[model samples]
Target: MDAWVSHAGIFSATIKFNEPLQVAWVNTSGDQVTPGSFSLDPLKVKSKRAYINQTVPFTIADEAAFSAFTSAMITQPNFTWHLTSDKLDVRALAFPTAHGLHFKKDVTLNGMNNFGRARLARRLQAARDDPAGGIVFSATTGLDNSSAFNVNLGTGSGANTVIKPGSNAVTLDGRLVPQTGTDALATTFELFTKYLNGEQADVVATGKSSIQADGRAVSWLSAGLTALELHVPFVAPGGAVSPIKAITIGDMSLEFSTHAPWAPVSNSRTVLAAMELPFGFGLEIEEISNRGRCRACQLDG
Candidate 1:
């Protein structure tokens, strides 16, 4: 016969960011996560029965975890949340409140062939014919019939490229218009082209390529447990050690608070620097497996 054992006590927690080439993990401190601080929110409806299942809440451990959590929030970077107990391990992904666009290379005209190919060819031919004459190329911003940015290549292709918010506008010459700032479609084509070419003009005039979260916001948390391991000790009737069984939780959500750093603050003061805003997140579990083995039986065999 095998006797079961119970594991119930305080556990350790760790949080880590999954970034390219570098991963950061922070341990919880007493100041960050207080004792008996874990909780789940109750779902409520105006005229219906309330659901008691929703988001879980917990405080960060200390100044270090708080600082790290703050950084992750502002940067909108990806991170992993972990909770470890004597017999269980829980984990989840904490999504960012905001994200920005990043362009890896410069935009050029040679790549576009649909709209301006013939007109550009005519301009080049005309320029060659009159050595003293130069091709006139100009661009402006305005709403098209569809209320999108009207991008004219100034060529006689009779084709107009329209740009919408959160979408890229490709010119007749293969230039990529960035989808950044509040009103990117209002930006002049000349400035838009220059900015994509790595020119440092007034970003305000061209529109910002990135923006941070102004206040507390929430984002999606995805795929929960990357790995989970549990250890359960078993005892035999004769007081001898029996097989040890390992159990794992397949799915769970790990939610917590995270602050967006909209303004800069001095890091010298630990308390002031460690403040974090509220946020919630959850991660889905992929799979779960278990196994049991008896050392005493193995030795006897």
Candidate 2:
């Protein structure tokens, strides 16, 4: 097709379960989804514009593993979304007489209308926040149709970064994401393994767009999951698995979740806070303390 989206970094996605779920995905939207592909030339991602929905036997192996996973949720990182595409030359028209109005004039950010990156950045930073200070935005960047979370969670990054963190950094994987084919549940678990092992990320990062936040960008994000079965396949070497250990009283849905940007609080974000299951009833991540163990930029492995 001549009309191809070279920067459609991500597209459609979906997930299926091997068992039942206490939670489920209700997609009556009837969006026709077809198979797709992934490549570098055009940044091809998922094809069908469906969120990856899978039924997983969500489980935790050992305490360390559990800690790692939970840390991913609570750990903080400010992803500086550099949304300047090279297609067009963006520059500022700073008139010496404009009396310091609005950062700069013609500062290359052409109102974020022409490209997906700029648009996503605009929506991501719209909620009383700084343009370059994205705490945990992928989880809240439903900035544009080209965004993954906006495509997947049906209400991704634009949701709640923190169930209610009093900080700019939000959820680990930036919860909101563009649709893709990788099994999110499985991938999330795999990340834990890598974290446990402290291995180098699969894809070496390069260029100005790459921001290293302790591997948090690569390891943290997993689309919400659903299934009836109580089995999950995430096991670190020499580690054993067990059923998810979590309890809740109020609704764990994303509705009551707090919508705010990253800020310094007097206490730990997870202190006396409730972890929202996110989106629909995704795999309810067992709640635990934010021991500052989840290092998102670099992995221990």
Give per-model CA RMSD.
38.2, 29.1
lDDT of 1 at 86: 25
Q: Candidate 1 residues 1-301, lDDT tens each?
A: 0111122113322222121111123323412221222332212222222223333444444444444443332222223333222212222223332222221211111111111111111111101122333222222222112211122222222243333322232322212233456566556554434433434333211111111133221211101101111111111112222222342334433222235222222222111112221111121348533332222221132
Q: Whole-model Cα lDDT per candidate?
A: 0.25, 0.25
Enumerate residue pairs that collide in model 1. Answer: 32-60, 32-61, 32-62, 33-60, 33-61, 109-173, 112-173, 112-174, 224-283, 224-284
**Consecutive 10-residue window with the lowest summed lDDT within model 2:** 103-112
Structural similarity to truth (TM-score) of each candidate: 0.18, 0.14
Model 1: lDDT equals: 0.25
Model 2 over residues 1-301: C-alpha lDDT tens digits?
A: 1122222224332222212221111112422111111111222225433232322233332333333322222221211111112232112223222121121111111111111221111122112222344223222221222111111122223343222111122222332232245697577556545534534223211111112333232222231111111111222223332333453334221211133212212223333443331112223347565333222232254
In angstroms, the error of model 2 at 107 is 34
